[model samples]
Target: MRFRPSPATVAVASLLCLLVGLVYLAMQIRTVFSDQLKQEYAGLVLETVERAESARDQVRVWQQLPVDHPADASGYRTARAELARRLASLDALMNASPSAVPQVMSSALSADANLTDTDNLLSNASSYWRAQRDANSADVRVRTIHIARTLIALAALLFCMLVTAVGMYAKRNRLLAGQSFEFERASLHDPMTGLPNRRKLLAALEEAAATPAHQASIQKIAVLYIDLDGFKQVNDSLGHRAGDEFLIAVSVRFRESVRKADVVARIGGDEFAVLIRTFSTEEELADIARRLIACVANTDAQMGIGHVRASIGIASFPDLVDDYRRLVAAADDAMYHVKRSGKNGYAFVTAAGRSAVS
Candidate 1:
């Protein structure tokens, strides 16, 4: 029979794989998001520079415009409205990263702040300058408008960069979650048999014990320790590869006989273990043992050598030894007894004494 990894081993491996993959993905996400933010921020800086130049010219023109010109009033009104719109855009950009905003955006906002103040001051001075028929109103207006326009473009750049960064981060998180899932699957299963390995079996046993008692009785936990007969002989006679295949076939047969709640594992080599919970009586336990023995009692080793049989030992918590260690030892001893007597059977420690069947 081909020996296979216990379910616990498979699970542990699967979980480990998933965890590592998730960590990798998380790291990737940080890199992706940061890079995206940096590139986007760089583009925004270019736009801000251009807009600032435009606003500067507008401010200068406003200052130079002949104050006596009737259109001066209308142009001033339009400049004021444009200034208000630019301020709103700047506020939006700064608000995006109250604490996390890029340094470039911060410097730009400060520069824009001076322009904002200039615009406010020009608004107040406009009325007076026009009354005095000043020649510089148009130039002042042109300069101020340039600054306002620059800040608006800067605000747009910052806002877009933040949005892109968030999107990249979110995508990376999703990738990490998927990797984690795969890791978990690796942690709890045997790679060969795809069964619950030793770790998973132990966990399942503990969980079963914690459930409500069956039929008003406390739950009973059983470990059936199985030793394949003539396993070594087969390894010696046939190639290890064939022996491995045989063990695998035996494992499949053994698993097919058990309920889903029951957990089975190959500890290593030719030894296997099955854990059962909530058996109502010894008879229930006996029936399970019989099923297992029948499953493994092959008439040949597939190559038609001698028969393949097994010795099974059962130990139960509370009835056998109290704790986990003793329980396993008791079951192991019983299994040995079965092997010593005759191969294809089971043995269990009972209050009456140890009992074995050939």
Candidate 2:
């Protein structure tokens, strides 16, 4: 049969997608902020270089005029102010720099400081034509800032790819989880009957018995071992397809007749089991057994599905040795007694003898 996602699987997938999408969003935002910070720092570096160059040019003009000229002093003050502005820009970049970018920023700052020294030397030169123009260290710093900006761009690109990859992985895992649940459903459950198969039932029984009765925190356990009667004749005459439909109907009735907390399973073919709890008396046990018979008998009367009667047997804790091995043994023996006495009745073994229902 074709599979659809169960409600449980769908909810889990949605939660996973939401969490991954949120993580991806966080990554994108971080990259954007990183890029913006890098751009602002690059602009500040360029501004520093420009102001330093302008100050040196003014100093050159002052040297050409006169050492004692009023305009020469003004030119010197302007150069100094430009120098102060360059220093302020440098300080700001240093303060706001990311820890990861410290090495690059430190190297660039060294180059910028060397260029400022050159500008200061130009201001104090004795001869106008003998100004020394050495290596373009500040320009190299500017190129390095451009290279640092490229790092930001590259980081953003890589972050985008990383987010995309993680999102795809999350979606793939969600799909696989859904597929696993589908496989489990097909394996452990009888699709038409909606009851656990023999394998699953046996496993459940084993797990239950592995824990002590005291650990169960429950007292007085009761088991209803059920086998449907006249099922084969119905299948042989009405066809297997009709027989399946009948079994489905019977399965629904069987479930409805029991307490909600009971463990019900189709052991194989027409045999079923129910583990009912908290039955502290024989009357309480017999009540449930009678109800099971009534459910099948009424279902047969109403649906006419070829004698919808069930042979049921009951066994309880303490009386059945309070262990899985003995409890199953007691219920099985009672079920055999029910089958032999008369097919459409219920039985429970006692210390005296078997008690069979009329």
Q: Write the per-residue lDDT of candidate 2 for residues 51-100, one digit (tens) a residue.
A: 65576566556557765878777776666566555555554654565543
lDDT for model 1, please.
0.65
Considering summed lDDT, which 10 consecutive residues are worst modelled in model 1? Answer: 128-137
Q: Kindly provide the TM-score of model 2 when superposed on the true structure, using C-alpha atoms.
A: 0.55
lDDT per residue for candidate 1 within 6-124, as digits (tens), equals 64575565566556645655554555455445445434433443354455456567757876876896775566455445444544543453235322233333433456454443343
**What's the lDDT for residue 151 in model 2?**
58
How far out, in Å, is residue 250 in model 2? 1.6
Quantify all predictions' global Cα lDDT against the true fold. 0.65, 0.65
Model 1 CA lDDT for position 295: 72
